[model samples]
Target chain A: MELVVVSVLGADRVGIVAGIASVLARHNANIVDISQTVVRDIFSMIMVVDISKADVDISQLRRELEEEGKRLGVMVGVFHIDVFKYMQRI
Target chain B: MRFDPREIGEVLEMLVFRELDIRAVTLSVNTLPAIRPNLKDALDALSHLLEPYARRLRPAAEKVASKLGVRIVTVRLAVSPTSIMLEPLGDAKAAVEIAAFLDELAGRHGVDMVGGFSAFVHGGVSRGAAALIEGLAEALNSTERVAGFLNAASTMTGINLEAVRRAARIVLSLKPHAAARFAVTANLPEDVPFMPGAYHGLGQPDAVVNIAVSGPGVIEAVVRSLPDADVRTLHDAIKRAAFKITRLGELVGREVAKELGVAFGAVDLSVAPSPKVGDSVAAVLEAMGLPRVGAPGSVFALALFTDAVKKGGAMAASTIGGLSGAFIPVSEDAVMSQAAAEGAITLDGLKAMAAVCNTGLDMVGIPADVGPDVVAAIIADVMALAVHLDKPLGVRLIPVPGARPGDIYDLGGLYGRVAVVDASRYSKIPLVARPGTAPPGVERLKKG
Candidate 1:
């Protein structure tokens, strides 16, 4: 499976998760795990997704997520899971 | 699979806030095999061999950067020492032509710079080395995308004072900014991704990929996170940060090499800093509790930090080459430049720091009146230190024309601004005039 980690950070607001989830659903990406937290009104969400079945490639998915994030007033980043594995696991 | 939010946040913080990124990914191409009896044939052979790789480097680097969500700064190319290619032709004019052609090729292919317009005269000079040296002033002065190096000292071969003199003269003759593109090295490593010291050594493969990681900001952030931690704790924290940083470089390097269909070489774990805010190595030292970079305990602080970086890099990557330590290039780092401007760091103090760091007195500006003998003496002193420590070190200086001590020469952009440091006190070392290689250091006896 093509695993990826999607992160969104910004000022806390409504529809942050729903906005991201809708994009992922439209692309047929499966969110396997998610953890989120808020501190001093700043919101951060991390999601691990399997993009193997997604119609869009990683770059295209990133652009779409980023555009959605901009509409929601947030910063979004999508990275191949191997980066986390290399930097954090080892 | 378990995912820790804090771990994810830490990686993001390192990237977004600390400015952690890969500074350089250099493709070291072997061009010596392309040399022919005539300069035209040699140029044709080199163009045929190098064009495709240059065309592919930037795209491959950008792809990896996008995939990993990492910022890859500069893509560079290093050729096998052009002096060797000039050996058969035995023409100084050919050296300049090759440098210009490489410069044009690099620009055409979007490569930032092409290095290894070099002469390795650590022990003595050869006919080709002589030709290259004769034309170095013109080649470097004329080309914007070509970088040059002269390895004039080594532990095994000793110091060549004559070569040092010649290198200093070349420095004196270069245009104000062109000196930034030149370096005189002692025991320069082969696979360094950073110019102007990088060159594809004789021992390297035909084509390979090497990487340089930059993370002074990350290290400083780590140091600041532990406000009350002891020295050992700071060391551990820095080491951990370096491990993560090197891993990123290793991953990017291997992936880029795979994309380009070349061998994955090594990760150079130099904590490179830029003039940008929050990206200063001196700031890391200050975060570790030194009041300033050249403070009394500066040497100890540098030693501790450099050793921990190497330790962390060792654990992170299986194959490590190049100068695997911190680089304290004066003009390129804001805090370093400020310290120099404030008289907090002198050229002598920088020399002391280099005993523990990688390159010696790099990117420093000196007065134009210091003379070649004085500059050569400075280079000689760094070589002496490298021989004693038996490690690689180098010197790259800019003698700003018509500038005086305490005057700042604003080189602008990555070159930054530099404060002219006094080299007059040591200005009259007669030892530089003697034209022979100093005997090899006692450190070489270890091999026996």
Candidate 2:
């Protein structure tokens, strides 16, 4: 199983989590952890998900997520769990 | 279970509309003219000098605004005293020409306000400084973004009756549209990073950054949440909140200075407020048990609030300075403005309040016909208080054109709006004319 972290940031609006979650669920990704905070007009969220489905490619999932993010007026970036953990340690 | 749409709408509104976090970006630019032989050449130099800075200023400001997710209300510039450049302009025509040049430059550059069309004749008035004062009304009236100031006295240099007298006349004659942009001061500090008072001094770096952190809402929210808190408890809570706010301000100011590669000037922890509901300096005073800001106990309340804020801010940052007190700007503060409009506060009430707070007679709109000597007298009273207390204080009263007592002038924007405050009909009391004499100092009390 491959673990990944997805970070999203943008103006606080409707359907941000549901859209991202729907895309992840379609790829058979299991959400493990989620944290979110709203400060002023901006919304920020971090999600950790497990993606072990052999049929879905990580690169293809990233493209789909990017499209979803653009449609939702949010910025989304995906990173390997190991890389995210390393950056956090620093 | 069913959810109410009204409740959801209310929550969304609270999230999006209720939360306001905007920072005022004041760009300090020196307007001391580059060496030039003719007026045309001088204007050209002015535009040329500003062009480079202007090109990068708006974009950088917009980027910061976007990143912070807060609106940048103004992209303003503060120039060195125009009096320095007006030395060669011997007559009113020549002075007006300089004003025109400045106005044109400001318009072309898309700057909202340009300060430093001023003179600092604390002890005595020079020829050029006097000329700037004489032409001030015309210059201010003719220009859109130009602001003016006059430093009438200082501790080092005694009060200049000449400058004070002239400033009074200039302010009285100033147009209503331009009145908000003009300020008069005694002992105006050299390193002020705000305007219509910022002027790059020789002691400052070629470029320096200053921040004015304003969150009256935060303070008010803290106070309101503890409705049953005692005065001491309330003061303690305010201090803690102020410490956090000032620390955040210091961090942002330091980062911005690092990015600009200039010295980080002080973080002015002035609780500057807007006309928006629930953000007010007077509300803080009201929370302290005063029915209104001008009540009998108001001055003492202000003293406590001001002292506590300074104590907390000083502890928060090493470089805490500027007017680091609660701003009592009448028009800018919704409650104070309302009080003035309802006749709950008067000009004398404001003067009494200034004894404690650093700002005296700030943004208080008055009549145009008010004599300069009377204005000088009012300034003298406030200056004497500052000297007596040995604390920083300033007076920025606006004598709105064609306005009188009971008239309201709407300045709009961050300046907010104000109803005209009635001027004191009484005259001055005779006092000694000594300058630089230290007042009786208060002994510091040791806390257990």
Candidate 3:
């Protein structure tokens, strides 16, 4: 299964998680882990989601998250776990 | 799948946020534009120039911090030397105005400290630079977030007695907070990209980038983990850990430079400590079995720490530089602060320690009425050490303007706190009878 990590950050408000999770759920993504924090008005979150079982393309998933991010006034990006690990291994 | 509970616990421990791993990365950018037209223009341009970088620096730093599972504590900025930048201003008051402008900009942008308000007249001094140096004690005393330095000598230009004398006067007039912000140097390297002294030389391009990585806490942690570990084993472990940490810092620094499209100047493994408990260079020394910083074996402890850190960091990165030795700032290091308070360390003792280590007389507190000649004496002693040892040494002596010995001044924030050290009660010793060329082979003393 292809694992991907998604990070989101925006001004603190409600429904941020639900909005992003709805998009992930529609893509048949399985969230293996999630963590978040709110420091005053700034909100940040990270999720490890798996999408190998689904037939959806990674680009499409990215586009969906981007659209949702814009609607919520947040920054959202998806990265392959392998790419993240390689960048960290330096 | 077979799973061991202990292995599961280890994974969970990594995920749990027990410690806040944060590093302060300062980008020393040239801000000569700020002082070009007038104090107002200087302030406006500085604020504007830094606004974009401030916005981007956090996101960029946070991106890297997230990857490393650490936090970016503060994104600080250091500018080109203030004396040269304010040369057109032409007076001490104007220099102070420019310093205030920079201080205001730093406060607005949430920067911890902004450096480079300094003069490098090691050989001779210009009239404008002299006036600025005269006002530095007051400027640093009155302002927060402003740091200063004076480079009194270089390998090319021999030490300037006049500038050194003026620096002594400034230090004597320095208040506690101001004293902590000041650094005096000999043979100041051109490539130092970090604070209180970063300036874009006329020879450099429009802008360049450098990185300073501090992990005294990490070193302390490594040392603490090895209970009953032999000296050789301890040294090897410290070196290996420093190598790994330096490699990680080099990787991040290179990436940042690549993203910014600037030259990667160098990676400084300075082991700089914070005021936070357990993250101090002094604590590292104490861990090595010194009863306190100025204890009998303090010099040996610092020497060993400095040598091992250099050995590891030099091997880890090709271009390693800066004040890369273990920082022994009293206020910044918990153990040092405690030692100073308990009279376990004296000003002379600290100077002795600096002779065998990196920073020279850093964050040391002293009385206000101390003579300029004595302050000059301290600087000269450290200069002699640097010259004799052939390594970089800096004196960040804070002469509290009104406080006397046994008095403690509380300079809040990372500047830390310091107890006043007794000033030497005797007459000053004369080192240089007259200003002349340095003897041949003096430069050879700096090898290593």
Specify the highest-TM-score model's number: 1
Summarize candidate 1's per-residue lDDT along B295-396 as a digit string, tens digits: 999999989899999999888886998999989999999999999988898989999999899979898999887888899999999999998899999899
Ranking by DockQ: 1, 2, 3
Report the CAPRI category for model 2: incorrect
Better of 2 and 3 by lDDT: 3
Q: Write the per-residue lDDT of candidate 2 for residues B90-127, one digit (tens) a residue.
A: 45665677777767766776766666778887767776
Q: What pairs collide in candidate 1? A: none
TM-score of 1: 0.98
**How would you encode candidate 3's per-residue C-alpha lDDT over B1-448 as one tens digit per residue?**
2223232222222222112233456566666666564656666777776666554554566566554434456666667777875676667887787678768777776767777788888667876677679779778877988887888756545556667777787777766667777888866655465555555454444455556666676677768788788888988877875675566556666665565555666667766777777678788778878777788988888888887888888876668866677778887776788788788888888878887677877777777777667778778777667765666777887767687776777777777777778868865656533454343236655542
TM-score of each prediction: 0.98, 0.77, 0.77
Candidate 1 residue spans exceeding 4 A from truth: none
**Error in Å for residue B245 of model 2:** 2.6
**Alpha-carbon error at B271 in model 3, in Å?**
0.8
Ranking by lDDT: 1, 3, 2
